[model samples]
Target: MSDMPPSQARSRTKVKPMTSKGTGESDTGGVRADVWVWSVRLAKTRSAAATACRAGQVRVNGQRVKPAHTVRAGDEVRLRQGDRERIVVVRHVLRKRVGAPVAVEAYVDNSPPPPPREAVAPAGIRDRGTGRPTKRDRRDMERLRGLAPKPHE
Candidate 1:
């Protein structure tokens, strides 16, 4: 303060590290379930994560937990969204959301591989601006879906 300029003095002041941008670990020992899910990109939004928790789609260590439940390192977290389920173990407790690469480091994923594409039936698509399907078009669509009987050769 005695010898340095104002700019230099300000620059010398201790700066606090940001909680939002780094290793995903916080000073706190644990993080909330919804916040953790959203931080790791498991849920699209914080509210969505909470909703899933309320619906019993999220489980911690094989037991269903509320959105406010705390998650600690080494705990298993299971999240089910529609037809897919994700199982992960907490490696680090994150307080804020980070980049994809950083988020991946916070948890160890143990989800099963997705089913083969061939096992899923393809849906018939119609071009935009096209009117409703005619009877013949509807029949053809049904046949493609395996919902209508096939004709003899």
Candidate 2:
């Protein structure tokens, strides 16, 4: 019951192959910076990657770039998240998100090792049936954690 010709319908259904800019390569196409980050599991989500790019927390080859910036193999990307910074060198350009193991192969992490965890002193714990802590108990707990001065008397 369709009026359109078969040729017209076929043309409309054609899918374009992904390609990289300035290169005729279809298998290794350049992807957006944010997409690359998210695809490789660097960021939890694509929106997070784009947000990081917008906040100037992402850099490529030492130059700040936008979310739409093109990323190719061999590009060095640096991302800052909270107190830690991650540096990774692109080994492969991936367009779609992949599994953790597969994603690891797409980049070479060049970030410094994380800081060692400090040994924390044991904190005072009240009994399960105990009610709200008294002001004096709170102050004692704070002092134990070096948060407040010890009582004079």
Tens digits of per-residue lDDT, candidate 2, 13-105, equal 768777444222336558899999998888999999999999999999999999999998889999998888999999888887878887888
Q: Where in model 1 is the C-alpha error above 4 Å?
A: 1-22, 139-153
Tell me the RMSD of model 1 versus the true structure: 6.0
Q: For candidate 2, report its TM-score.
A: 0.69
Best by TM-score: 1
Once superposed on the true structure, which residue ranges of model 2 sit more than 4 Å away at CA? 1-5, 8-15, 19-26, 119-153
Candidate 1: residue 139 Cα off by (Å) = 5.3
- The digit string of per-residue lDDT tens for model 1 on 29-108 reads 68899999999999989999999999999999999999999999999999998898999999888988788998999989
Give all TM-scores, in the order shown.
Answer: 0.74, 0.69
lDDT of each: 0.89, 0.86
Clashing pairs in 2: none
Which predicted model would earn the best lDDT? 1
Inter-residue clash pairs, candidate 1: none
